[model samples]
Target: MEFIDFFILAFSAVFLFLWWRTCFTKTKPKNLPPGPPGWPLVGNLFQVFLQRRHFIFLIPDLRKKYGPMFTMQMGQRTLVIITSPQLIHEALIQKGSAFASRPPDSPIRLVFSVGKCAVNSAEYGPLWRTLRRNFVTELMSPLRIKQCSWIREWAMENHMKRLQIENFEQGCVDVMEICRFTVCSILVCICFGAKLPETWIKDIDGVTKEVMLMTSPQLPDFLPILTPLFCKQMKKAKELRKRQLECLVPLIKNRRAYVEKGENPDSSMVSPVGAAYVDSLFGLEVPGRGHLNEEELVTLCSELFVAGIDTSTSVLQWAFLELVLNQEIQEKLYEEILEIVGKNGLITEDTVEKMSYLNAVVKETLRVHSPAHFTLAHAATEETELGGYKIPTNVNVEFYIEWMTEDPSLWKDPDVFRPERFLDGDGVNVDLTGTKGALKMLPFGAGRRTCPGLALGVLHVNLMLARMVQAFKWVPKPNEIPDPTETFAFTVVMKNPLKAVILPR
Candidate 1:
């Protein structure tokens, strides 16, 4: 038995080596981007595993050694990480269509993304367009968002009161937990078209987070050939997906019933009925795929919660941390808020636009601490050339967001947290939409695949920050400074969650 086991291991290793050499080396395309050479069979897969959670930290050193655009062979998967802003512009903006689609989802992702049916993971095509259009037109339109101001106001009031209560009772609030609930509360209303009880919302938040964490990149994600060995993990992922459906499918059914009756889903709230994402999907037909089934509806609605919650929560957490650390900046922002809207004025969506410094602060936060350190991997639709290198069809291209935002050549004093730069210097007339010219920074990404919720996301951050500043003075706890060291979750979050003292004005 021992001899047979050893023989099987040796044969498997030899087969993989020969397969790698035949497929990768012999059939390699000319002038693929330069990168660190890898071992015969495994390639850089071991290095990725070695770095573990800190793999993000290794990219900068690799960028310094290899040029801006480089490749890595992760078993059968080939990834090109692009750090040069010009090269990013060339690939994502200049030739956007060639790089519009997402790479194929892994097995775990297939369960969550429901076979690429969600907007974020769907391939670029008529199906993607139909879904994206339904989302933007029904939910994200300016009038629709404006109608939902009551939701934000409701969440903000509850959030501030909760924070005040917590600060009084426990002396410090858990910023991430409290802020996550508030963001989830707002998104829950938008996605389900109804307000749910706090406990119910919390349950939904927990399950969605579990799904997100489970779907993160794993060894089998990169090396599909080894998938059979990780049966337990795959099984766990399916269970989580089932749990997610259990939490979300009921909401989808409720919305469908409400739409069928032509009645408002949430009459208690003044926001327009039939504007919920689920409501819009009831009778909508994909060009080639006909009307979406219930599971697809649940998946798309789940995408809303998955996409908006963490990214917005992380930004709010980082913005407050920065405000707590930089007292002068905080004071300046408060003074501007007072001048524009008065001491006790509520920072509504309409009022938030009038505050230039407030907008600048959010922009600076996004630049310094982009919630997503890297854009979602984009796959090439066909063979293309970028930065004088050949990119073969279906290869994943990832842009390093932090590198571009912090590059010295792009912004003056790039490391400094100076919102004034946008008002006066190199960031002046900068376009967040990469359509104008060379890319400066992409917080929500660029081109056809750009986040449709870009405007809503910025508004959420700006409104939350302004109201927090107006209602209370944020300061670090006694002798400790707010630690801004980043750790990766679904989004880049503070390693040390911000714990601060909030004094009522």
Candidate 2:
């Protein structure tokens, strides 16, 4: 009995030693980055849980405590935050290949499925490259975009006409709704072949409008099961997804029909209107990437519309509000447009580039009203080291983009909406949004995934701005103060949504 007991004890000891070695051995991840300490399993998510809008106030505090790059745990996941340009450049631009992958987004899959159309959410692979290339070359290319100039002019013309109608006697206009509709019209024309089927058009527009609210920041992305168990938001998202899907599926079918006919879809394009983004993207297969099916095409279209609508519209509305609030800057931009572009019926792409002050105004608005507050999100594809710490595979990373843009260290007068700061304007460390240096201000985000539509967004903002300002002068509503208060349902939206009267300039 004694001999048997000894043998059994020895066996148990060996087994325990081996199990411990296997479980605790971490090779590549031993030296990632450092961050805030938190309780085991639960993480520092509680610190960010209930903000008026997803931790905006907490961001500055976090930056203070942890510096630009810090560590936090959200539920079972551990994450690293990158706050500076150098670090962001390293991860996104320099080591683009290894760190470019996204976290598992099974949730988005219920709405958007596989293939060439799902560029943003698609796994980092050839298919995504194909779609991106298509967008860059066929859609946003210089020649192709010029072809669609007529579409933009048409959309801008219609938008100005609507503003004329809504300007409360052409003195003040509802900047928020008007902006949303303007962006929606431009995106619609570019994406779904302009004159869409009735059901399709309504479907795309309704969903496009709702996208701003749908992507509202949630801490539960890291702990998704919690969303199913605790959040009512999932239910609402489901209902909205159904509404969007119904509208989009038909447009995909229509385009597929056009592609099936040997005729190039580009034939129907109206210059400066629907241009070749639609004209160029059809039935073409990427070399390594497979062709997109119906569902994929629909998802891509949906992404473009949603992404375009809120961000573009919000910036335009804010630009106008700044103009109304600061009549001086408004006049400055107007004078530049008048001097160079001549208050012409159309503000062409090149014409937009010439007005430097107008460019500053748009940049300033983006600076103060930075969208995608927590931008460097999702996961890493591989294990890597950032700032002397190991980032494990699939670990979620968060960057306080809005906070970084507004960081006093980066901007001289961060709170003040001064477009002049972007001019030959001088300050302590260069003004982040200044035209020459953009590394500091990540209004369009940073890295390989930095907004592909940056150039287009710039033109969109400027064109709409020049057209609206030249066509009508905005006035604050009588006895109603314009509220700069922002509540994030996505894109750091104006809490009250800028309300004003329009005066024809």
Runs with alpha carbons beyond 4 Å of true place in candidate 1: 1-26, 262-272
Q: Using Cα atoms with residue i matched to residue i, what is each candidate's TM-score against the true structure? A: 0.95, 0.83
In TM-score terms, candidate 1 sits at: 0.95
Please give, for residues 1-505, the per-residue lDDT of candidate 1 as tens digits: 6998976996697667658765767566568898989876667878777776466788998999998999998776788899888888888888999999889889988988778998889898988999999999977888889878888989999999999999999898878889899999998888777888888899899998998899888877776767876899999998887888888887777666676765554553333457676777888998777998877888898888888989988988888888888999999999999999999876898999999999999989888989887888898888888988889875778888779888888998998999988899888767786778678889999889899888888888888889989988998899888888889988999998989899988
RMSD of each: 2.4, 8.1
- Which residue pairs in model 1 clash with each other? none
CA lDDT of every candidate: 0.85, 0.67
The local lDDT score (0 to 100) that residue 241 gets in candidate 2 is 67
